[model samples]
Structure formats: C-alpha cells, structure tokens
Target: MSSSPEKFSKNAVIVNELGLHARSAAKIAEIARTAKSKIWVIRDGEKADAASIIDMLALACSKGTRVTISADYSEDIEILNRIKALIQNGFGE
Candidate 1:
C-alpha cells in the first residue's frame, strides 16, 4: 500500500543499556519490513525509515532517548505498537 501523511504515533524510550546499536536496529528493520504500511522512527524532529538499518542507526539514539514510532496508516497502528514494545524491551537484548 502507498504511504500516507496521516499516521498514528506513540512515544517510547530506548531502554537498552547499550542503546539502539546495529543489532537492535536490525531487529527493528526486520519488523518494519513485515508491515503493509510505511513505518518510521522519529527523534529530535528527525525521522528515519523503520525498514532501513542505516536510517535507524543514523538516528543516533542512545539509551534513554525518547522517540516516536509511527505508521503511515491507522491500520498499521499495531505495527507501531510492536515497534514500541521492541524498543521498550530493548530489542530483546
């Protein structure tokens, strides 16, 4: 499906001690790939494609960083929630 400007977002903090590192970014990207709608992680007014490891890493999100996880469509809200849960869980680190 095409991405829309409209989206649902939830704020979350990076709980992993090591932060959003390569391994954790990979997990987030993997989840993003499964979503039918576009997904993104926004931090400090910067947004990154959730499916791109490089983009996620670019956020420079360290532990305790606050970010907003959003999906382009309401139907994809669950996807964002999953992402939030992953971040809250420290990407299972």
Candidate 2:
C-alpha cells in the first residue's frame, strides 16, 4: 500500500457567462463528489471546498476569474482532469 496520497493541481479560468454562482457552484460540487480526492478551489488567495456549493459561492468568482484547484487522492488522475476541463469549458454554460 502507498504511504502518501497522490496530488493534483491546476489553474483554470471561469469562462461562463454567469461565473461561479449558485447554479454553477452546484455543478462543480456535483462533479467533485464523484471523486475520492479532497478537492479545493482557490481564488484571490481564498480557498473553498469544491464539494460544497456554499463554499464555492463564497469565493465570489466572476467571469474571467482565474482559480486554482488542488486535489489529493490515491486514485487515477482522471477526476482532477475532468474537473479542470469542466471549469475550462465554463461547465458547459
């Protein structure tokens, strides 16, 4: 068994028209819950749990905002990548 968990981190821009609002935050949280990793999003030096809609909304991210995401898990990297793509694609708007 591994002694330490694998980690993933990346920066993504909020390109959606509405930014990181309640609905968008819900979408992010929905996807985040599928992974075993603990995911966190950082904006302007403030960090929020990606699995929590309220935490995400508290970041107050607007369109064109840049955010950093970090995940720690023992599973494949697909989860983190998927989240990155979702943010990059503006969560399909």
Candidate 3:
C-alpha cells in the first residue's frame, strides 16, 4: 500500500439520542470490518479500532459527542462517508 498519506480523516458529532450502543455500534463495526482499510475512532483524544464493535461501544458515544475518524488507505473514503451519513441520519432509527 502506498504510505503517501492515502487517507482521510474527519471530525463529527454523534446526533443519535440513543448514542452508539450495541446495535448501532454493531452496525458501524460490521461495515468497518468489511472495508479494505484501517479504520479508527477517536473520542476525547483516545482512539480505538473501528472494526471492533465492543471497542466502539466502550467509547460510550452519547448524543452530541464529538468523534474524530481516521482511515488509512484509499477504500476508506466511502466507508467514512457512510459512517458520517449514519451518524447524521440518526443511524436510520
């Protein structure tokens, strides 16, 4: 893989009232695991593996929580976008 910074990062807020609990975290983790890239989520400057549902849920992302996502590799863009959309759309209820 080209280590030429072929990555994209974004800071976003969690808008879901229920926060990133098990089901929501599962959804995100499932998608992240299928991606051909390394994904991470940062909260309060602490980062965790995005592909791990347990790790994500441990973050306890409540409503209005800010998170920084960083993905290393080209295919990460679409995945990141979907993640952002999920957060924005309230995890589709």
Candidate 4:
C-alpha cells in the first residue's frame, strides 16, 4: 500500500500596499509552476490554484487579507515556504 504524501500549509497576511494583484499573483504562479505537487492559495475558505494567475486574482485578496499557502505533497514544502515568505514580505513591493 502506498501512503499519501503529507500536506504542508502556512498562513500569511498580504502586506503589500497593492495586495495580491496581477504582478504579485504572477510572481507566485512563477514559483508555483515549479512545484512537484499542487500549490494552493486559500482565503476565506476559498481555494485558488497557485499556478493560475487568473484563479489567484479572482480571489480578490486585498491588503491585510489573511491567506493560507498550501502544498499537496511534502516535497513542495519549499514551494510553500517561498510563497508564504513572498506574501509575508508584501511581494517585495
């Protein structure tokens, strides 16, 4: 029997003055695209594919919005951390 990979998640608040806009979403999608498993950005219980800029933008997360960065597989923990750091750092705005 195969065991399911462990999920990794981290919470971060949008600190950028512009919030999670197109540029920031694109940055996240860039990193997420390299994940070994799925990466998700969740806000107010809604989940968006981190690899999809449109999906992330649809969340409409403004500054100060709290979100969770999640990875489906443990192998993606680095990806999860990178996203969390990016959000926490306000996308380097």
Q: Pick the lDDT winner.
A: 4
Predict model 2's lDDT versus the native.
Answer: 0.81
Q: Judging by TM-score against the true structure, name the best candidate.
A: 4
Candidate 1: RMSD to truth: 2.2
Residue pairs in candidate 2 whose N, alpha carbon or C atoms collide under 3 angstroms: none
Clashes of 4: 0
| Model 4 Cα lDDT, one tens digit per residue, 1-93 | 123323478889999999899999999999999998888899988989999999999999999899988887788899988988888888888
Clashing residue pairs for model 1: none
Runs of candidate 3 exceeding 4 Å displacement: 1-7
Candidate 2 local lDDT, residue 61: 94
User: What lDDT does the true structure give each of the candidates?
Assistant: 0.88, 0.81, 0.82, 0.89
Listed in order, each prediction's TM-score against the native is 0.90, 0.85, 0.87, 0.92
Candidate 1 — worst ten consecutive residues by lDDT sum? 1-10
Compose the digit string of candidate 3's lDDT tens values, residues 27-73: 88887887898888889977778899888887889999998877888
Q: What local lDDT score does residue 10 receive in model 3, on the 0 to 100 scale?
A: 72
Ranking by lDDT: 4, 1, 3, 2
TM-score of 4: 0.92
lDDT of 2 at 12: 89
